[model samples]
Target: MHLNYAHATRFNPPCPPSQYAGIGLGPRMKSAERFAGHRQDLARKVHEAGIKNPQVLQAIATVPRHSFVDAGLHARAYEDSALPIGHQQTISKPSVVARMIELLHKNKQPLGKVLEIGTGCGYQAAVLSLLAQEVYSIERVRALHDLARTKLRPFRIANLRLIYGDGIRGLPQAAPFDGIILAAAGLGVPDPLLDQLAIGGRLIAPVSKSETEQQLLLIERVSSHRYQRTALDEVFFVPLQS
Candidate 1:
């Protein structure tokens, strides 16, 4: 049986506050207010860590990251550190996420359409939704894909689409993305991803340098067949899988 696993799940915009009357907005408001401060602090920390892009900081401050992690880990959600999200995968730290997104925005123009190679707990995708006109995220692990959908459903991010499939293969149907980002590290940028990038588009990912060392890599498609690669900061991430 040939099954198409690359189905996309689109989220709708958040419902109006009036719709929460039955649930009582008091608790919800209180929780949001509490997290608002933590988000601001986290953004400040990211700024101190050298993330200068104001829009990137704003996106970090706006997204409710706690919703993407387990309830028990909510206290550490705003910390500048990664947290395990099951299946041996972890969400990227707030600073790292900000840094990568800032790189994508290096051109200082509104992003048209972006592609995320790994959805993880859907944290980065949620943040990208705020910055990009459209975002398509793919996850290879069935459990993580479903988990990302569950975690992201409440926020109702209309611009974000979650797809269950192999991240390594890239989403050919949605190719020619304005920007592409990979959350996991591979030996080098996959050829398909490079081919999927629109001319002048940028792709950022962690590339393994050795068995124990990895570095952030930036690849820009300068023309139809020309690309520029630059090795960046040392980092670590789960190996990109098929």
Candidate 2:
């Protein structure tokens, strides 16, 4: 049950497990050694990689990484590499996921609501589910949604609304998020994301290109239709799929 809701919402409450147990993660299965090992690895890697947010670290640790991927790849579950989660999408590397979360909350304020632009593999969405008060996640692929919804069955996250659409457009009706995170890279920063960020809120993503890898950009919504952009670091990711 604890592992089951890792993808649904970011709520810190405990939830019951779903009986389906797709990919062998259910009541009948126990991956204690694997889970514990991944927990320790995440602790070391996240800290080594400079993830300063304790809450984010705990959320990453608590959410079972293995359950979101192909069960056959269980052995590589904790590796600091991205694995395919179908629809040609891969879960962002654990470090990348944690870093983005840390970047989103760098200003040290309470986030009222969050908009997650890409829900690939649902790993990033799961992490956001635990940290933000509310999450509006958009997934370009449909099959991923079905998988994520089922995996999130056991979590107490009630504030997340998953939508299947273009990651570039974002969720308009639920705009004005306190924080925004884009999981896929795209050429230039998407205007819709900036438009949706609430004042004093931050948006993090890679300002993308075709030939060059994108740089991690942190934009703060200073006023309506205005933002302050700061370059965080260089990052590589799948191009944002519309």
Candidate 3:
């Protein structure tokens, strides 16, 4: 069944001091404290908008978004807005991330191996690692790929792998993923990505419906050759490059 919904936009203020009491603080504790505080605030806002998946919400709270962006913008890390991550790409808004993942989770099965197109700064991949058993992320820009590798390494997210390549091509070696997500908007869903999804898998992305509008889309592979499409909230994302 095809479904479409208007985008619900909401933003909340930073978390209060009481919220950061128990988060550990050894070397990066100060930054960790800020992330904890802001992530809670972001999760609360995402939940208020109807994202009820506890795992998704917890992942949102646990991932340190500030680490994905430039240090100068760390102060705005938890503000529910996208931050530029160089190469003219931007980290996706926290709400959009939560919404897409929530929709994918509606598949009602464990997300085994997930494929992520556009691994900008590795923020989404980090979150996906928490939800799925393994995550394969592809980014086209070598600079961004290298940067994301460095940023994500310290986290020791062993289940996540970053690849520098053409994201539209998807990963054939890692085909049949249980879930696929794209960070950049494309004219339409790429066939390679569809072919890589397992029968019960779900792929979420932003597709350009017209020159002026792009809509969030969910594609679920029901059978070998049968798939269902659902159009969701209006969204803005960097265009996918070849």
Candidate 4:
């Protein structure tokens, strides 16, 4: 179920009248108007790609993408491309995000408490908050976590608890998560995370040599110490810093 971006690298333009709800003066037209426009494009792309969950697409549309990025990049928030969120980290592209969520939901039925490795700009966590019952997100960079918190302030996504620490260790206290999503690329799957997944739980990540081509892995915890795995298509991202 891995989708190689190398083949589907089409980029869409950003929203025409871009601005935040509380921060900016406002959308060019009404907030709903601009949101609808962006929602249509996002939904069309996601639906055509076979994302059946209507709730997922609705979440993509409702989330104010402009709020998740730097103000300078707000204009490109709706575009289907990755934008820098500082700390040498770039928020993953929209298409990739959709693809990951799609694969994450493929076989698993009950998506309960979730652990998110590499909180990044918190955009991914925000999306997870909508999909999962509870979300524990770990971010290596303190400043990045703080910035992401503020960006997601409006949503008051209470289900997401951000932790600034090494994501490689995962969240032990929140172990036995129903699902886990790792945002950064790593050389190998960290054992602590697998130790944390509930039996039959699924964890998704990109594994490969740092700074090189990485394969998306959808691993399921079949027992306390064992896992079943399937490799998806190629992806590239910043190396996970220890």
Q: Rate the local accuracy (lDDT) of all candidates.
A: 0.81, 0.71, 0.78, 0.69
Per-model TM against the reference: 0.88, 0.83, 0.86, 0.82
Residue-level lDDT tens digits of model 1 in 50-70: 999888888898887887899
| Backbone Cα, N, C clashes tallied per candidate | 0, 3, 0, 2
Cα displacement (Å) at residue 186, model 2: 0.7
Off by over 4 Å in 3: 1-31, 107-110
Residue lDDT tens for model 2, 177-241: 88988888877777777777889988998877456768898998888767898888888887876
Cα error, residue 87 of model 3, in Å, equals 1.2
* lDDT score of residue 46 within candidate 1: 95
- Give the worst 10-residue stretch by lDDT in candidate 4: 1-10
Ranking by lDDT: 1, 3, 2, 4
In what order do the candidates fall by TM-score, top score first?
1, 3, 2, 4
Error (Å) of candidate 2 at residue 27 is 6.7
lDDT, candidate 3, 1-242, per-residue tens:
10111111221121222322211322354657745777888899878877889888888988888888888998888888888988799998898999999888874534688888988888888787777766788888989888887777665555566777888998877688889999988899889999999998899999988778999999999999999998889999989778
Q: What global local distance difference test value does model 2 have?
A: 0.71
Against the true structure, candidate 1 has what lDDT? 0.81
Cα lDDT tens digits for candidate 4, 149-208: 666655545455777778888767667788888887888888888888889888888888
Stretches of candidate 1 off by over 4 Å are 1-30
Q: Give per-residue lDDT, candidate 1, residue 58.
A: 86
Q: Assess the local accuracy of residue 152 in candidate 3 as a C-alpha lDDT between 0 and 100.
A: 72
Candidate 1 RMSD to the real structure: 5.7
Which candidate comes out best when scored by lDDT?
1
